[model samples]
Target: MTFDAYDTWWWPYLFVLVAGWLASDIWRFIGVAIGGRLDEKSEGLVLARAVATALVAAVIGKLIVFPSGAVAETSLLVRIAAAAFGFGAYLASGKRVIAGIVVSEAILLTSMQLA
Candidate 1:
């Protein structure tokens, strides 16, 4: 039977439930079923890691170079300095993600306040 979401309030919920399952859950189930067979040191996995790292670096570069809202108001030198300090903190903290992010944000906010 065909469901019309516009005709009933409950139909929208049903539609979303079914559509969401088909859109995401199916892929998740497929991944779970097949993912176990993949080797940890496979070339594909290595490439995936490299691509993910590149994407993250690209995003960080974008944020530093083209910030928005209040961050955009800060000078380029301040942003670069903040990023440098954060990177240093990350290295100093044994490559901790939280340390890098917190130090970066603290530097940015403090610079903003001072400027």
Candidate 2:
């Protein structure tokens, strides 16, 4: 009478699919529905964008300052240098996200090899 997800192989996959949809895709659908009515230059949208950008920056800062796993193996100087070069690449590449990521990853990989 009791359902045990672990008792069946397909149940775990079904649970994961349902959980993933609820966790992420549902938010996307909601955002699309509500965002469709908002003006591109609305104050609400601008504030939301600013908040999102700040959250990303804070996360990046945390990773650099209090790194864990493989990244923690590198010296603080290496991390900072990589971030600086990545920012410069971002700016020089007309603010392209891919440019920043590629430059930062390359710097980190090279530094890790050298260290």
Candidate 3:
């Protein structure tokens, strides 16, 4: 006899949850095991950090330049202004990430309300 998992709604969710957890958690555990032996200041680690930072910057740039969903409804000017002001807030607040996010979100919402 063959069992059809999709016949039950919970089975799909449970399958996805377990599969996703296993997929990511395995790598996380492996990283924990290996990361301890790596030097934080090594060239490889430095390059990894740089690449991660660049990816974040690229994502932000993409959202600002070619957003989707609600963000796409806002004008390019508003998006650019929000990002610029957010960066200014980050700098003015001594590089606190939360401050940058709060300021950026505030700018976006306020401008959306006004427009």
Candidate 4:
């Protein structure tokens, strides 16, 4: 089916909603279905966990090392310092993820304001 603006303005929105759901939610559903059966110590589970952690680390590393937009304008040293502060907060807060995120964001924003 061909989509034309004159045909319906809402078509594009509908298309994006359906496309995005299929692209992301399908995998989530499949993961839920399959993940339940996997043993915690199974190699596949271990690899999946490692891969997920690596992906998160890679994203964080990219943001720190090669930021874009306004963040890119910040000095690398300041960015590194903010990350260090966040990591320290995380460790000091008994590894609470939210605490680390909040502290890091506060430091980063405050540094930006000062800079």
Candidate 5:
């Protein structure tokens, strides 16, 4: 028995899709069984939210301040300028997370275009 290119290359991608969905659905099922009760209002939930937010912010900060790969070639000043403007727009939009994400992405694309 021999394995072809798909067994070596594409099968990994297929496995990732299947495994990723299975892993993600575990959390979804847990949340569903929990059902948004006082559990949602618990200290643990609040802490989890804060920690997740902080982790995401830290990643974004690292990307802007010390990007790697091709983005590393972009000027630090440009990154700061884009982040500042994005943060401003985020604040102006009443601190909506989606707005902040969109603004940051828009700024990144604009910066990439300039680069």
Candidate 6:
């Protein structure tokens, strides 16, 4: 019955957040510092590239299939159409990601209104 009474759950949540941040960010900072000493075309870089690609794919797949907001409320077909429109724009505009994103968002908004 009080703001300061988070009780048993608070410590675990705090610990997880702090630990996750430290685990991820510490190595990320070290990577930046050690980047100049590392080879761009190394095996480690290749593994990192693969992991990054997989994560990106997972995020995009989630967005197109199982979003978690107003976007989640929209139909899959609508989302796909919007994405396709945006991608087409990107291709037409010399692969400019920002332009593609803007056009795609506009398409999604207009389609949602029409629906």
lDDT of 5 by residue, 21-67 (tens): 77779878897997866666899889989998998999989988999
TM-score comparison, 2 vs 6, better candidate: 6
Cα lDDT tens digits, model 6, 1-115, are 3434466768666766676677789988998887767787999889999998998999998879888878877889988988889999999999899989999899889878987
> Which window of 10 residues has the lowest lDDT sum in candidate 2?
1-10
Segments in model 3 whose C-alpha atoms lie over 4 Å from true places = 1-29, 32-36
TM-score of each: 0.66, 0.62, 0.66, 0.66, 0.57, 0.74
On lDDT, who's better, 5 or 6?
6
Candidate 2 achieves a global lDDT of: 0.87
For candidate 4, give the lDDT. Answer: 0.84
The superposed Cα distance between candidate 2 and the true structure at residue 110, in angstroms, equals: 2.7
Query: Which runs in model 2 stand beyond 4 Å of their true positions?
Result: 1-36, 96-98
Q: Is candidate 1 or candidate 6 better by TM-score?
A: 6
lDDT per residue for candidate 1 within 1-115, as digits (tens), equals 3666268778877877887667769968888988657687999889979998998999989999998887899999989998999999999999998998899899889988888
Q: Write the per-residue lDDT of candidate 2 for residues 8-72, one digit (tens) a residue.
A: 87886677677765767887889888875658799988998999899899998999989999899
lDDT score at residue 96, model 3, on the 0-100 scale: 99
Each prediction's Cα lDDT score? 0.87, 0.87, 0.86, 0.84, 0.79, 0.84
Model 5 pairs whose backbones collide = none
In Å, residue 27's CA in model 2 sits off its true spot by: 4.5
- RMSD (CA, angstroms), candidate 6: 5.0
Candidate 5 Cα outliers beyond 4 Å, as residue runs = 1-7, 10-19, 66-70, 93-115
